[model samples]
Target: MPDETTDTTAVAEQRIAALAAAHPWVSEARLTPDGVLLVTPHPRATAALPTPGPLVGEHLAHWEEVYEWTYETAEGRHAGDLDLSGWRASDTGEPLPTAHMRDWVDRTVGLVLAQGPNRLLELGCGTGLLAHRLAPRLEGYVGTDVAAVAVDRLSGAGLPRAAFVRAAAHETETPPVRQAMEQVFGAGVRPDCVLLNSVTQCFPDLAYLSAFLHSALTVVEDGGTVIVGDIRHAGLLEDHFGRVERARDPEAADADIAARVASAVAEDRELSFAPAAVQRILAAHSRTVRMSVHARTMAYDSELTRYRYDLVLHVGPAPGTAAVSETRQLPWPGRGSEPLAVLLRKALSAGPVVLHGIPNALLTDAPDAVTPHDLRQALTGTDAAVLLDAGDPRMLAVAAPADRATAATARSLRAPVGRLAHEPLPAFVQRRLPEVLRDHLRRTQPGTVLPRIVVDDAPKGAVR
Candidate 1:
């Protein structure tokens, strides 16, 4: 077998030579984009140059560094010789031929096709996995990346259905690439769908990610969809399992194991987002936004790996619309919000209710507020009850002392009034609001009933 260092040096030399041949302007190459050192006639003159838009030049600089690292240099060895293969294999996995990432790419492509594809642009199109999978189903496909090597590789692979462009994430705002998009697709050639799968999380900052999103919106047609599949946050996994296993010691271990696997896969990088935050950012560009998580686990090298990606589907206005109106509304549950909550309460009444917004805080004001204990008491006796927030008068009816005996005594006081104290306000309101009003109408008028509740004006200072 060839010595690892010798093999790596040969590979690096070839890569450096290739990069130099392609981009003659590059002077000194670093390992990453941030480390790229461009040689100019005057160092001060280069510093005085106008700031480039987004991070185009920065991305190019990183590409140069990656190129240099691939070369056999006397100073330092390239980690890519080991890191790239390891990362690629870890991402795609062995025996799969492609990386484990292909599974996610396939899933995302299926989603895009289901949405109805006219044209599509995939940002950070690493290896063109998505574009290749989706090209056959779409009218046109374009994939762009910061690395010229990726573009050349995809092109050489004969992905004739899709065109590969060497453009950085920040360069979409500039000419050339933007102009090429306009000329190829015509004036209003916004892609019907834009796929950002496991891509945005790679960005070091939210500003870069937001800028990419903003630029993407310009080429995305109204009523188009943006599909984002990436890890958002790691703490969410801890919170999720911690709450689920609080009661049983045996079950807690399983939760702990799962959390560890999730943390390992994510590597503590903040990639996941609360559903509400996803909604807020997407809402500005689309009329209706929907998000769902497809959770799965894989075993590799005797280690369990957990994969969960938040899939956001942003829908623009239908073909004919006078205007696209944006509104702040409750996030719609994957199924139905109200029904899901009601069923959960009925099945697991004692369990702590965990609420998370679609992205951040788009669904409800108190995204993480646990159901109050008073409401839980009200829910025990009756099939359901009206749920109210902290300020509602109904809340006053259930507020009791924290002691078990005191709470029991308070429950006794409300029993004669046909009210119970254990039900959650949100859960009760979700389940019984309609039925309660309907029954009230039957008693008020024997034969006819009003379609919806009608509240008479309350006197000034009267509690609702």
Candidate 2:
């Protein structure tokens, strides 16, 4: 008898090809000999790909629809598992290293615990990644999200002392924070710590973030903590896209990379903030709130470590509460003069260091741009910590738009080899491919363009 599996696969491929042929977005779909399916977009459809600029009133709805589809389609798989929460992968569909994810969680939880909060309220707690890990240690935990499916699933988990509610990041009044407060803590109580981990990027703009911060401060008890973690650095936006473009086509000319980076920057929809911007917003809200920015201590030097940092605000803290050891300010020796590895190594050995106003390496045609990997290697076996902070806002210059048109958005198609035959191409693409693409790109692209900071480090374990 002929193999049944081969016959089934052939049928599935035929059906998939037919579906792709009918889909307006797809020009062609074919299975490789290795069973990977490749779908090319229709040439005319490329122009119509969404040009997402500043998302004004519709950002909340956009994210809700995005995550609702995420949890709804990923229901059957063990998507609820802590490890799978905010799952990441490369453009080629290979999962990125999980060590960095673990580092982020561990460090964030450490920051929360350091706050010594009795009860914790996390905004945008998609899949309860932190809540699940944090609930047992806290007196109470409340997780909020825009996706009802995420809320429902996390609610069903029965995690002790933890409650899941459906609410947008900017809207704390809805679903009534007081109601959750009564259920989690005692009546007429409030959580001491409010966390928005990996949540700020989804915000439509700084205005939305400021509003959320203001609302969060009103509910959080005096002297409480508000942790804004995984904030995209506005300064390194272009350098970030430059790195991605370089990786995509290593042999591409500098002009091509610059053009692509400009196009990507223009279309980016995520909200990135300068540390200075955060400082300004919080200062405007209340001077009593002390804030400090810290760099990621993850061992790996991926986009997260390179282009993102965390902000911790101490609500109503005493004066000098946020003070750190005097940081030795070092003017960044431009990229062409001294190797960054040498500069950083010397700086850390002397004491805690901070370098301001560095030029962006990707902006110039310097091929030997010192990467985070080089900085990490320089710091190996030392007590010092190293990180790149956002640079002066004036140094960043915008590139002219790319002449070539590219897809405005990537459709996420989820299919296990031949299994997508029954699913519509548009649905599958929206359901599968774009989520990964967004997550991957979200870290790499800044929502806004700002200056670039080359190196910022603190010694004696101050930053770590």
Candidate 3:
């Protein structure tokens, strides 16, 4: 008789190849001698994948369909889904070190209860993990998610005081929130606590967060606490990545990071947010907000991990109260107006520069923190310019349009640099401009064109 393991491998490989061939998105597939089958999705087809069910609106592009499909297809084996072991696995992000998640969860439960909430609403509560851990302790509890599977499976599985619903955070007045409110206070009362735990990433932008907040406030009683927990902040991304890189030996760090990336790819999930932007939006909207750094946002971790923030939004505080952490935008020139101007001014301050470095520097502190306004700011001012050789648009990440910056709107930047003068450059500029502005003066030879910045090139005798 043939061995069971050998037969299983042969069957698995055949299924993999067959599936790859059948899927319209699968661009290529190949099997290695070791029985490992590799499959690649067509780039465009993969990008166009949308949510499975009817959405609130077609306009909610990124959040509406992107998350719907992502969560629905997520396998139980993926980190943060149903994999308790993977929750503290090595080579991933965690609040404390992987070993300390038990303590973290316990502490989080304690902190949440400390708010003295009688009836609570939990948004984005994955797999009812917290409910399993704390439902018996609560008077009444409710959970919600965008994934229908999670809702259908756990809707009635919780304690007598608990229930689950399929709902999207960005949707206006979701049924879950209404049902949750009813469960807690019959038909006439609001929830004492509305917990948005590890759910901010599901939102596409700050506007959606603001919308969600408004909706939550409408259904929440006065003095009710809206807890935004387990926020994966990008402000400390570099610092955290640096630490994770240092924990393992050099080779191990590289391999570990590679493994982490592979896992993210497999799950079709990616989550990142800039703490600064989050603070700014919250400050402009909520009067009182308290941020606590705790809990593992990413689920997995290396030996050491850092960089997730838990925030409490005190909807309506008592007589004398203020935000625990009040954030304000910097008073930098051209501050709120345009991003292109700000980017150029900052980049040129460092002398001759590259357009890519400006946005990259801005992101060093917070991923996706640079908004449309910031990108517009960089292109609004003409203080200086960057030089670079034009190549494939893909090579210049900015040229490819996405949700962040509208690259097509900045088409003027693609013009030959020599003909371009003091007109406001786009958020990004690329030409082989020399290190110094004087590089242009040297290119006086016939048919020789060079790109360079013009820092007050007006005849010195003509103006001050």
The estimated TM-scores of all candidates read 0.44, 0.61, 0.46
Pairs clashing in candidate 2? 391-452, 391-453, 412-429, 412-433, 412-434, 413-429, 413-433
lDDT by residue for model 2 (2-103), tens: 899889767765654455444554456565665544555444332211221221333456767877887677633343555343455322344456667767
What is the Cα-based lDDT of residue 403 in candidate 3? 14
How would you encode candidate 1's per-residue C-alpha lDDT over 1-464 as one tens digit per residue?
87998786556544433333233222232223332222211121112123322222333354445543432231221222111221232323432323343444454565467567777777667655566667667677777776666666666766544676777665665675665556545665667777776555444333344455656666667767666655443324443333323433355567576766555433433233333334345556534433333221222221112223334354543333222121111211332345435643543343222211222221124433322222333344533221211111111111111111112112222222211111111122222333433454356445642333221211111000
Task: Write the number of the candidate with greater lDDT, choosing between 1 and 3.
Answer: 3
**TM-score attained by model 3:** 0.46
lDDT of 3 by residue, 99-138 (tens): 3555456545755785678878787666565666666777
Model 2: number of backbone collisions: 7
Candidate 3, superposed: residue stretches over 4 Å from native:
1-99, 243-271, 274-276, 286-305, 319-464
lDDT rank, highest first?
Answer: 2, 3, 1
Off by over 4 Å in 1: 1-102, 237-272, 283-307, 318-464
Error of 3 at 73 (Å): 9.8
Ranking by TM-score: 2, 3, 1
Q: Against the true structure, whose TM-score is highest? A: 2
lDDT, model 2, position 370: 43
